[model samples]
Target: MEQLLDEFRSTMDIPWSIWSARLVGTVVLCGLIGFEREVDKRQAGIRTHILVGLASALYCIVMQHLVVSDEFATDRVRTDPIRVVEAVTQGVAFLAAGLVVFHQGNVRGLKTGATMWLSAAIGLACGLGLWGLAVTTTIIAIVIIVLFRKIEQKAGTHVPGHKNAGEKEA
Candidate 1:
């Protein structure tokens, strides 16, 4: 009974405006990155990215509340928020790794994997209420995903362990 009540209170710990802002901001930022992936027809598209972002943010938000609760408030608990981040990182990395593949001496889905990783990062930043960092990171990611890809294609740029843009697969 007390545990149930604690969960309810944790949900309400943060004000509506702040909570909504963090979630919505995460959606918009992650959405942009996901949109690019979708346009590229990547396996991990908008929905995957958005969900990843929200999950990451929720982890931090919930941790913030629990950290202040009596269960964790005791000095003996010695709570450090970095653990939450590490947990999120490992979780996201597992998901992102699935999108990556190695076949025939060429790696694929590298960009999608990196994007998924970044989505979690953006989510964490938004959840921590670092809107500026989240927004800036999102913009930079978009530029790299969109503009840089175009440049690489047009220039036939070479990437390690992969053929140049114009090279035919063996």
Candidate 2:
């Protein structure tokens, strides 16, 4: 009884303001990338991106609470935070794999899948209170998706048999 109370209290020690900031950051940063995808008419859009980002952020927050609560145990079980990160990556990879498709000798969704993976990473960073990292990464991803595509088209690099890009997987 007392043990449960102590664990609960420990977890609740985190400030609500901090929690709100992380969650909001995850949404905004991930949304920017998602909006890019929406503009491109990709399958995954703003809602999907926001959902992934929010879920990832929630998982990280849960992990944080668990870690804090673990401290109140009589037998403090040391946890490797890396494990939580690995778990998140594995889950995100599963989602990313779903976004990819191969058809007509022209692979599609690879970029979208990669974007999903990036969204997860950004969400994780936001959840972990790395606002700058999340923001910078979002900006870089937007540039790669938006500006790079323009550059590729202008250079005719994205066309099949173009010099810049190799043949997609058969």
Candidate 3:
């Protein structure tokens, strides 16, 4: 068991400590957001959110290492950070799309999909060492999910696409 762990650690060019910190942060942030979704009976909840965030963070870490390598610095190999961001965004977009459902002319799960996307973004931020950004975004997400729900309920405002009376039947 010790040898297996050592081999795995050696395979990672990054220090295991760094990986541990980023992954844990990703899990925590995503888990908190996902807990809210779970409470609301979302199909994709804590486990899904944690996995998505972990994957994004791992991708970012690998890309970061490649971009900073000496080969790129010496050979003038152009590295565009936006490309990495775009790739992650596209991957997350696919997952988000899967979360949405259109049934009988009504669209549902937009909030769940959006929150999943946010989880990926927070993971990316953590991977890039933007700890402050990830924390702030998580707090804001929780606030929106919890507080806004109360406000919506008290005001009796039907969400725009959620079976609103003015919406036409498909």
* Clashing pairs in model 2, backbone N/Cα/C closer than 3 A: none
lDDT by residue (54-164, candidate 1, tens digit) is 999999898887777676777677878999999989998998888788866667888888999999999999999999999999999898777887887678763423343
The alpha-carbon deviation from the true structure for residue 21 of candidate 1, after best TM-score superposition, in angstroms, is 1.1
RMSD of each: 3.9, 5.5, 4.7
Between prediction 1 and prediction 3, the one with superior lDDT is 1
Candidate 2 Cα RMSD after full superposition onto the native fold (Å)? 5.5
The 0-to-1 C-alpha lDDT of every candidate, in the order given, reads 0.85, 0.80, 0.84
Per-residue alpha-carbon lDDT of candidate 3 for residues 1-170, written as tens digits (9 for 90 to 100)? 99999876654457779878998999999999988888777788899898889888988888888777765776558888778789989999998998788876767778889998999999999888889999999999999888998898678653433453345557
RMSD of 3: 4.7
What is the C-alpha lDDT profile of model 2 across 56-113, one tens digit per residue?
8888887888777745454657756777778888988898898676665656778777
By TM-score, the better pick of 1 and 2 is 1
TM-score of each: 0.84, 0.82, 0.81
Model 3 misplaced regions, further than 4 Å: 1-14, 71-77, 157-170
Off by over 4 Å in 1: 1-11, 156-170
Clashing pairs in 3: none
